[model samples]
Target: MILGFGMDVVEIARMARILAGPPARAERFLARVFTPAERAYCDARQDRAGRYAARFAAKEAAVKALGAPAGVRWSELEVIRAEGAPSLTLAGAAAAAGARLGVARVFLTITHDAGVAAAAVILEGAQR
Candidate 1:
């Protein structure tokens, strides 16, 4: 069964600008949105722009997968990489919301082309 689904697109320039702003804002934003592992991966990557784009797409895709509205904060859904693939780790209200939505696991894919990055998320639930 399908629990939920989400997809998102982002402009590389926008994310780059956000990252370039006050360091505190970026830190706070990243703390809320990304898991430790995810943060580590991004931090270790030499392609900062690619890392930013991936995270941005993941956040957008997560909101869609959860079937939530725009107000859903980026911090609610975190994207991590495992074995070179993207995965999801939900926290706080995001977890509860996922449960309410009957989502058991979330799968995510992120890609970048030219100057744009995009992501797609799939939520899997118990087969009914």
Candidate 2:
């Protein structure tokens, strides 16, 4: 059963602007927003900004899926690649919130196209 659903869309150009900033500036934004694994994965891709944007959307979607829990931090919700597909894991306060909300499983999917990036999350569990 599904408990919640959420989706988000980001303009690739927005992330591109951030990535185009000075090295330290861009690093600061990336470091604050993404986990190391996400940074590494996106940095290795040719469409780096698009990849980053997709992850950003994923993070937002995950938070929405949890009903916008206040304890969840940006970095605490990680977007990852498992078996060549997008996956998500909630950690720290995010995990605690998910547990409290009865989130048994998190389903994630992300895509980029025509200068836009988007993501959707489905929270599956015993319905409340």
After superposition on all C-alphas, the RMSD of every candidate to the true structure, in Å, is: 2.2, 1.4
Model 1, global lDDT: 0.79
lDDT per residue, candidate 1, 1-128, as tens digits?
88778888888888778788899998887777666767787879877777878787887788777877435666667776668787877876778888888888788889987889999989899888
Question: Which parts of model 2 are misplaced by more than 4 Å?
Answer: none
List candidate 1 segments past 4 Å from native: 69-73
Local error of candidate 2 at 13, Å? 0.7
**lDDT of each residue in 14-85, candidate 2, tens digit only:** 999989989899988998899999988999999999999999999999888888988677999898786877
The C-alpha local distance difference test score for the whole of candidate 2 amounts to: 0.91
In model 2, the clashing pairs are none
TM match of model 1 to true structure: 0.84
How does each model score on TM-score? 0.84, 0.94
Clashing pairs in 1: 5-65, 6-65
